[model samples]
Structures are given as structure tokens and as C-alpha cells.
Target: MIRDKIRELLKKNAEAETNFSLEKPERAEFGDYAANLALVLAKERKENPRKIAEDLIGKIKGNREADIFEKIEIAGPGFINFFLNKDAVLEEFKKLSKLKTLLKFKTPKSKIQIEFISVNPTGELHIGHGRGAFYGEALSQVLKLTDYKVEKEYFINDSKESSQIKELGKTVLDEGTSYLTENLKSQISKLKTKIKNLKLEKPKNLYGEAGYLIAEEIQKDNKKFIEKELGIKFNNWISEEKNLRQKNYFNKILEILKNKNLVYKKQGAFWLKTSQFGDDEDRVIVRTSGEPTYFLSDIAYHFQKIERGYKKIIEIWGADHQGHQKRLFAVKKALDWQVDMEILISQVVTIKKGEEIKKMSKRKGEVILLKDLLAEVGKDAARWFYLQKSLDTHMEFDIELAKKREEKNPVYYVQYGHARMASILRKAKSGKISPPATFTFAEDAEILLIKKILEVFDVLEDAIKDYQVHRILSYIYELVYVFSVFYRDIRVLDSKQERERLFLVKETKKILANLLRLIGVAAPERM
Candidate 1:
């Protein structure tokens, strides 16, 4: 938000549509914040950037917002560095009447639908699914802060025609054991009588019916586990079989494509001219054997998402599905997808302990379950570990580090910072936190702590720009690092500055709790 104000001032002074960089300086002595407006202007005017920077600094000093800055200096190559007045920055934070006034930021209403972790109903959720699960949850939390109406949905791959459900049927009917884990065996055991009735009812394709029954039970248990144990929730549970096929969406889309002359028959198979819409090649929508390809069902499902009126749709999928993204984008172009659609591929995760790396061999049915991981290292640590890295990077979960209870573990260190702040507030017998009308103290440590707290807003704004939830987690770590330095250098309890320091501690606690909530992690009063 402060960055926006700074940009507005730069634009007003430049007297033209402007684009410039404003960010924190790499080193502390450079200043609290730095910008490159002078360099951008120099490019246009063909003038010395240092001279432009000096003139711009004078203009900024004339504006009312200039009062918030303690010093505005022109640095190397016309980079403008801004140092904020401690009292002015604190006043900006204090004007908010309540925590929500600052925390629940408002933006223009935009309807968004985020879909992730749509695993088949064949087995328990693996550690691979954990990435998308926490990623989607954290993404929804940040979106809500910016006043986006985000619908977190899970698509159930329960279509009887799906190869997975068919294979699961063989396991259910005792014909073969595929994806037959102990938990799935329990589900099959519970549905034995129904499986028997299905055997008696439809002898020809009993695998499909039997698979459907067991899949329903498995999905029920999976949903319950997400709610109770993992603390994740979904707004909708859309089924591939019930929601798309039962409604005849696939058939309708086929008709729409055919009428538009986008479909043609070649070599006894129905082909879609996907290459015309920017795909690398044409693709088959239906096989020569008269079975629809997976692409047909995907088209139908996305069409429904568009019909439901989401202005923005985001899919967080596993790395294995990355190859399908270009074709999906082609489909969007062919069908004139009006909304903003993005697909993020979360790379593979491997468990690491010291020197050895344990990668999942799902083909051999050797995998780690998400629930099991949570049981091994508590839920907060599990969630934090799942989201520590960017989605594009292959995550190596350091189990040994995550298991540590000391300051070496980043999550533990952050949570400990919140606990220490809470302890400081409790020592002062503070009531519900309220920002004072003004901050009368000015110390290097205290001012730096406030700057870190303000960066919380910057991190959230960045996440909204790119939907990168990891930014929020990263900022909490830096915030705690700054808090540790502040608490170590300055005395808060039984000191001359007890009153002002207590106020700082209480504000830090609130800031930590808000950021932790955004990342779907717990902020403990005591650890």
C-alpha cells in the first residue's frame, strides 16, 4: 500500500504514464525503500539520471506524503532511497480502527474459482498431493483478504469410464489387487454386501458398479480426513461421473464443436484441429473404438466452470500433468474462454534425511501418505514444510530439519517468535491489542520491527499479483528474524520503555497471527 502511494507521487511529478521499480534496498545503509524513477525518466529525456533524481526528490518533498519520509536521497545512478519517519509510519498504521481494517484488505470484487488436488478415488492422498492441497488452501486465504470471492473446489475423478476406477474395480471384486492399500481394503470390506448385490445385479460390467460403490466410500473418508485432521475445507465436491457425464455435458460440447466445424473424422477417429488454436498438434477427442478420450471430459468440465460464471479459474495440478497445459490453453482459445485461466504445475516432492533422498515410486505402489507425514511431524510443521518452496521447484522435504524442535527449524523459529511476543504481552497484563494514537519511542530496533510488520502487506500484495502463496510463508520467517533481533537488543519488560515496547510486542503478535492464518499454519500462544 505504501508502494502504491509512492508510485502515485512519482506519476504526478513525471506528468506522464510511468512504470518504475520501487523496492527495499539490499543493504540496510542504502535506505528502508529504494526506487529507480529517475533512470526511467532519463531514458525518455536523454538527461543525466542523477540530475533527474535530485529534481524528483524536491517534488516529492513538496507533497503531503513527503511528511512520512525522514530523508529522500539520490544514490548511485539515480536510484532514489527513502527512509521513513518512525512516528509517521506508526501513525499510518494506527489510523486503522480494528485489526480487520488493516488485515482484511478490500479490492474490486472479482469472482474466482481455484481447483486443486483432484486425485482419483483409488488410494489415500500421497505426499505429492500435499503440495497442491496446502497451496490451494493458502491461495484461497490470501484471495479472501483482497476481497476476492474464491471458491475452493475439488473435482472427483469418479467416472466409471475412467481407467483408474476400472482398475480399482478389479481390486474391489477380488479379481486383482491394484491400489489396494490397507485403508482401501477397509473401505472395500465395509462395502462387501453391496459389492455382492452389484455382482448379482450386473454380472457383465460389475467392475464399474463395484468400483463406484467403493469409490463413494473412499471419497467420504478422504473428505472427512481433510476436514478433521488436515484442517482443510472445500466449497464444492464436483464429480466427473455425476456432475459432468450425468448432465450430458460431454455430449453437448461435442455437438458444439462439430457445429462450429472444429471436429473432423480421420482414420476412423474424431479429431479436433487443436493445432489451429496454437496447440503443437491435432488431438483425438474420441478413439476409433468409440470411447471418448480424456480430453473430451476435460473440455466438458471446464465449460461448466465457465458457465458457472467464475471470472478467474486456476488449476493447481501435479507435475505429471504439465504436458497437458498447452493443449488446455489451446482449448481455451478455440472455445473463446473469456475468463483468466491459469494452470500451475507443482513439481515432484522427495523426502530427504541428511545425505539420502527418498523419492516416491508410485508405480511400484510405494509412496508416503500425507496423513502419515502429519502424524510423524505435527500438522503445523507438515503444512509449513509442504509450502516452503515455489510451485515450480522440485521440493525436497527435509524430514530431519522439520522434526527439530529448536530454532534451526524455520517453522519452529517463527512459531517461537509469536510465543515470545505473547509472553511479553502477558507479562504486561495487556488486554485486546489496540494501536496507540501515536508511537513516542524512536529506536533503530523498534523502527526496523515496524518495517517488517509493514512488509506483511507487501507480501500479500505480491501473492495476489502472481498467486504465489509461498511469499506469505517466506515473509513470516523474515518478520520473526527481525523480531528476534529487536527483542535481543532492546529490553521490553521492566525497562524504561516498557509501555511503548509492550505495544510493539502486542502488534507483532497480531501481525504474526494474521500471516500464519494466511499460510494455513497455526500460531501458538506458547510452544
Candidate 2:
């Protein structure tokens, strides 16, 4: 909020020739915050930029709000840097402790829908999907914290197209187009024989398509199994085919586009003039066979979001789907809707088994399922591992590291700090010990750790405001690193300053709990 006030001042003082932007200084000595208004003005004014910066600093000094700035200094090349006193930092902490009281700042809220992990139901979730799920879920939480009305959703593909995909699987297995065909005879025979051998009820005569059906049944079993095993659940499971076919929304949108001359007939198919909106080429909305293209259904689905009255719609997609963005943007522009759509791209995942890296393939039965990873490492560690990195970076998942029982895992390191705090609190409660009314922030490491704790709100605000989950992860790691150094030299329950140290530990746990909750991770009191 103070930052907003400072921005207003800069805007008021800015001339037609000048613009100012706040930038984080590379080093604290340069100043806590810096701007380059002078550099932006010099070209138009044809005067020395440093002189302009000095004049601005003098003007800033006379303003009443100038108390917010402890010192304003002109740095190299006309960079004006401002430093705030310790009170400014503490004020942020006080405000954060009462963050709920700050919601009045955001008014006239709009509904937002965030759909993530819309992974097809053909197979179990893998590490690749996990990134999107964790990141998207965390982002939704951050959005809610910022006072945005948010709805979390998942779009499941369980329709005629899904049936078509099942048919493809069935066809690969020599099943019938609608029923199981002959190619899957052997698997069917094997299943029957195994069922009979186990003294179970006899399986049906349908071989190929029946076999594929059986396979799908087994995969659904895996889905449920994996969900419980991985502790992942969705708020909604939307069947795309059913939704698309039920209301004929796709045809309606196509007709509207056709009427508006946005759709053109070509080669017995329909195409959208997507190239007009920066797309490399026009996209086909319908195939020659009269079947709607995936793009058509996607456009219809996005329209559904707009119709649902969600002012903002966010979709988390894998990197391979980046090309799809242009077409989606084209449709948005074509409709002239005021909706905001954001697509987060997640990088590929590499799975490692000890020193060996293996290719992941679902058809070849070599892919590592999310269930398998959770089973090996467990839900807490599994979730934390994925949340530790930026979604844009290619993540290397080493099974060995994940399966470790020691404190080598970053999650454990953070959780240990929490559990240690819990242990201290439990003992203190048992002995009826009380913390000091006034705690001292004197030790170098203690001061550093406390200052970092005070910055938790800032980190969360930055991550939410900028959509940078990596920044939050970085903040967590920094806090842990600082606390680790402090823990090495300080003891909480046994030290002479036990009460104050215990209080610090309690504060750390509370902050860590909040961080873990925001990222959809559980902070266990005992691990």
C-alpha cells in the first residue's frame, strides 16, 4: 500500500517527457528501491540526467510522504534510489498479520475460473502433469489470497472423442470399432484363463473390444488407486464430449462465426481466419468428414467459460500445447470478449532411476505413473519436490532422492524445522513455560531469520502479483537456509534463552505452515 502511494507521487511529478518505474536494486547499498525517471527524461530535455535525479530527490525530500523514504540518493547513470527505515519493514509485517483487513483495497470483484490438470482419462497422471497441478493449485490459492473470487475446475475428456480414443486403443488391440474386435483375442483369452485359474467368474466372449473395455476398466481402477495414493483430488471432473455434445455449443459458435464471415469454407472443411490474429496460419475448425476439430471444441469450451460469467479464465497446459495458444487467442479476439485468459506452460519431466534415465511412454508401458512416484516417495515429499522448482524449467526427478528417509530432502528440512518447533512447544506446554513479552532481535543469525520471516507476506504478494511460483519457492529455500544456520548455533528448549528461542521456533512453524498450505503441501507436526 505504501508502494502505491509512492507510485502516485512519481506519476504526479512525471512530465510529458518522463516516465518512472520502480526497480529492485541489484544490491542493498545502492538502495532498497531504485528508479530511472531521470534517464527516461534526459533524451527529451537534452540535459544531464544526474542533475535531473538530484533535483527530483530534493523535491521528494520536501513532500510529507517523504518520511516513507529514509534517504534518497542519486546512484550511477541517473538512477534514483530510495531507502526506507526498519519501521517500514515492520509495518509490512504488522499489515501482513492483519492481511484480511486489507481486502477493501480490491473492489468490484469478478469471478475467475482456473482449470488445471485436464489430463485425458486414458492413463494415470505422470510427473509432467504433476507440475501443472501443483503450480495451478498454488496459483489459485494465491489468487484467492489477493481477494480474487476464484473457482478451481478440471475438464475431463469423457465423451464421443474420448470414446474415439478408446476405439483407437481398441483398434490397436484388434477390437471392433464399437465393440472389441479379434486382435485382442489373446489378451481376452489370457484374462479368462487367469480368472478361471483363480476360480473367479467367467469373463465374456467379446475378445478385442471387450479386452479394450477390460483395459479401460483396469485403468479407471488405477486412476482411483493413484488418486488416493497420491492424495490428489479434483474439484470437478468435466466430461468434454458430453458437455460439447449436450448443448451443441460448438455448432452455435461456428454458425455465429460463419455469419460474421470469420469462418471460411475450404476444401470441404471449415476454417477460422486465425492468421489475422498473429497466428502463423488459418486453423481448421471442422474436418472434411464433418467432424469438429479439437480447436472447435476448445473454442466452444472457452466460450462456455465466458458464458459462465467468469471474468478471468486460466488454463495450465504442457509446453507442447504452446502453439494452441495462438488459435485460442484468435478466438478470444474474434468474439471480442473482455475475458482475460492466461495459459501457463510447464516444461517436460525427466525421470531418473539411480544413474539411469529412462524414456517415458504410456503406450509402451514404460512411463512412471504419478501413483508409482507417490508410492515410492510418499505424498508429502512427492508434492513438495514438484513445488520446489519453477514450472518453466525442465525438472529432473531422481527417484533415489525422493525415496530417501533422511533430511536430505528439502521438504524434510523444512518440515524438521516445523517438527522441532512442535516438539519444543509440546515440552514447554508440559512444563507450563511461557515466552517473554518482549523478544530481542539482536543476534546476527536470529535477526536475519526474523527478517526473512517478516518477508513471507512480501514473497507471497510477489508470487501472486507477478504469477511467479518460482519466487515463492526461492523464498522458502532462503528461509530454510537462514534457519538452518541459526539452528546449528542455537538450541531452543535447552538453551539459557529457551523461552525466547521457543517463541521464535513457534513463529517459524506458523509461517512454514502457511507457506505449505499455500502450495498445497501438508506440514506434518511429526515426520
Candidate 3:
């Protein structure tokens, strides 16, 4: 938001148009924000950078935009550093006294659908799915907090035509595959009675029927575990077989591709001309035996998102799906539709137990179930550890550090900071300690903490723009570190300025709680 203000000031003041950058300086003496507008202009005009910086400052002062910053100084050959007015920054940030009012960005509301953790119904969720699962849920919460209409969705690959589902069916029939586990055996046992009740043909439709039914049972258990244990609730559970294929939606899309001459017969199979639209090569839409490929179903699925009125569709996939972006873009090009599509591939995760990790296997075999991790480290720690890392990087989950109750643990450290603030307010029960009539922060610790707190707006803006949820964790760590320094340096109970300091603690708690909620962790009053 402050960047927008500087952008407007530069637009009205400068003679040339250049894409400038405004970044927060790592050191406070360099000022609150540093801009490279002068250097960018110097490159174009072939003039001295410091002279350009001085001219821009003069124009900014003339335009009366100097009120936005306390001082504008030129540093190191053209970097424009802006130190914000302390009182003005405090007025804006102190309004974050409630969790609901943090940032309050009035972005235009558009419908967004985020599909994540679409693990096939063939097996229980594993550690690999946990990354996208938690990332999607936390990102959805963050979008909703920023006033976007967001929905969480899961795509179930339950079609009997699917190779994975057919493999699951093979396990059910014990016909060469030994993937049967306790859960599959239980589902197969129930499938026998259901098949007997239907009185279907002996062997013709038996394999597909058995596989389809067992997958449905497994999906129900996965849904329960996700909602009950992992605290994730999807708004929609889209079925590949029932929702699309059963309704002939897949055939409809195939016909559209064929009618446009986008599909051709090659080697006895129908292939899409994705190479014309930027794929590495043409991809098969139908097998040689006339079965639809999974790529065809995915094309149909993305079309369905647009048909259902979602302007923006984001998919969180696993690392295994890398190099899959090209074909999806080709699909968009072939359809000739302008839509905002984002696909994030979350990397794998490793677990460290420090000699006490209890890793239980799922139905298919031992692959490290997500529920076991949640059971061992707990929901809050699991969420914090997963969300603290960037989605594109591999991560390790250390169970020993996650379960630590002291300040060495990151989640514990943030929560304990909030709890300590609450303790101060509890002891200073001066009947709703509100700020005095003329309140001004005069201490160095107070000024530093307030400046750090004001960056919450910039953090949220960046998260919304880039979909980088890890920024929230990084911001919280810095905010709390400065607050800890402020807490140690200032007196809050029975001091002459008890009311103003208590008010600061209360507002800081709101900001901390709101940020923790974005990561789906709790900010406790007492540890």
C-alpha cells in the first residue's frame, strides 16, 4: 500500500516513466524504504544518479507529497531512501487493534477455486500430500482474510477407467497384485455383499465394479481423516467418474476438440495437436483401444472450472507433477479462453523423530501416514512447520524440535510472546487500559516496534500478489522479535505510562493472533 503511494508520487512528479522498485532496507539507518527510481532514470538519460535523485526529491516536495515521509535522502549513487513520519505510521498501524481490521485491503472480489491434495482414492494420504494439503488450506484462509471469495476443492480420481483405480481393482480381486491391506480387505468384504445384492454378471463387469466400490469406501475414510484430524474441509469433492464421465462431459469436450481439427488419428489412437500450442509433443487423447487418457479428463476438468464461473483457478500439485505445466497451457491456448490459472508444485518432506517418532503405515503399505505425524507432533506444530517453508523447496520435519515446549521451538516462541503480553495486561487490571488523550511513543524501543508492526500491510499485499504464504511466518518472526525487545525495555504495570503501553500490548496481540490464524496455528494466552 505504501508502494502505491510512492508510485503515485513519482508518476505526478517525474518527466520520464520507468518501472521503479521500492524495498525495505535491511538496516534502519538506511530508512524505512529504499527506492531505485533515480538509478533507473540515470540509465535511460545517461546523467548523474545523485542529480536525478535530488531533482526528484525537489519535485516530490513541491507536489506536497513530502508528508508521506519524514525525510528523503539519496544514498550510494542513486538509491532514494524514505524514512516515514513516526506519528503518521503509528496512526495507521495502531488501528490494527482487532484481528478483523488488519490490512482491510479492498481488492475487487472474484471467485477463486483452489484444488489441492487430489490423491487418488486408492490409498490413504501420505507425507507427500501433507505439503499441498496444508498449503492450500492456509492459503485459502489467507485469501478469505484479505476479502477474496475462495473455495477449497479436491478432485477424486475414482473412475474405473483410470489405471490407478484398475490397479486398485486388481488388488481387490487378488489377481496378480498383492497391494491388499487391512482397509482394502475390509472394503472388499463389504463389496461382496453389495455385489451379491446387485446380482450382476459373473466376470464381465466384476473387476471395474469391485474397484469402483472399494475406491468409494476408501475416499469416504480419507475425507473423514482430512476433516476430523487434519482440520481441512473442502467445499467441493468433485468426482471424475460420477460428475464428469457419467454425465458425458468428457465426450462433449472430446467432440469439441475434434470439431476444431485440434485432434488427429495417429498410430490407431487419437492425439491432440498440443505441439502447435507449445507442448513438447502431441499428446494422446484416447488410447489405441478407444479408452480416454487421463490428460483428456484433466482438460475436461479445467474446462469445468471455467464453466462453473471460477475466474481464477489455482491447483496445488506434488513434486511428481513437475514438467506438466506445458500441456495445461496448451489446453488453455486451444480453448482460446482468458483465465487466470496457477499451478504450484509442492516438493516432498522428510521426517526426523530423534528416536521417538512413531510412524505408522497406511493401508497400501508403510509410506508414512499424515495422521501419524499429526498424532505425534500435533496440529499446531504440524501446521507451523509445514507452512514455514517455501512450497517449491524440499523440507524436513524434525519431531523433536516441533514438540519442544520452550522458546527454542518457533511456534512455542510466538505463542509464548503473545501469552506474556496477556500476562502483563492481566496483572495491570486498571479497568480497560485505554490510551491517554495525547499519546506519543518517545522511546527508541517503542519506535522500532511500531515501525516493524506497520509492515504487516506490505506483507499481506505481497502474499496476495505472489501466493507466497511463507511470508506471513517470516513477518511474524520479525514482528515478535522487536516486540520482545520492547517488552523487556519498557514497564507496563504500575508505571506512569501504564495505559499507553498496555494499549500497545493489546494491539500487538491482535496482530499476532491474526497472523497465527492465517497459518492455522493458535495464539494462546498462557502456555
Among these predicted structures, which one has the highest lDDT?
Answer: 1
Please list the residue runs of candidate 3 whose C-alpha ends up more than 4 Å from where it truly belongs after superposition: 1-3, 15-17, 98-100, 195-200, 355-366
TM-scores, all candidates, are: 0.95, 0.82, 0.94
Worst 10 residues of 2 by lDDT: 202-211
| Tens digits of per-residue lDDT for model 1, 1-527 | 67778878888987868778888787988887899989999999999999999888888899987887889888999999988877767765564324653456677688899999888888789899999988888888888887778899999988887767888899998999888888888888888888888888876557777788888888888898888987888999999999998889889999999998999999999999899998999999988977678888899999999999988999999999988988889989998989999999999999987899989988887799888888888888989988989989999999889999999999999999999887788878445645555577678888888877877777777788888788778888998999999999998888876777787887778888878877878888997
Going through the candidates in order, what is the number of backbone clashes in each?
0, 7, 0
Query: Which sections of candidate 1 miss by over 4 Å?
Result: 41-48, 96-102, 429-437
Instruction: Name the better of 1 and 2 by lDDT.
Output: 1
- Preferred candidate (lDDT higher): 1 or 3: 1
Clashing pairs in 3: none
Candidate 1's TM-score: 0.95
Q: Candidate 3's residue-wise lDDT over 161-188, tens digit each? A: 8877778777776673645667677777
| Stretch of 10 with least lDDT, candidate 3 | 355-364
lDDT of 1 at 443: 85
For residue 193, model 2's alpha carbon misses the true position, in angstroms, by: 16
RMSD of each: 2.1, 5.5, 2.5
Candidate 3 has a TM-score of 0.94
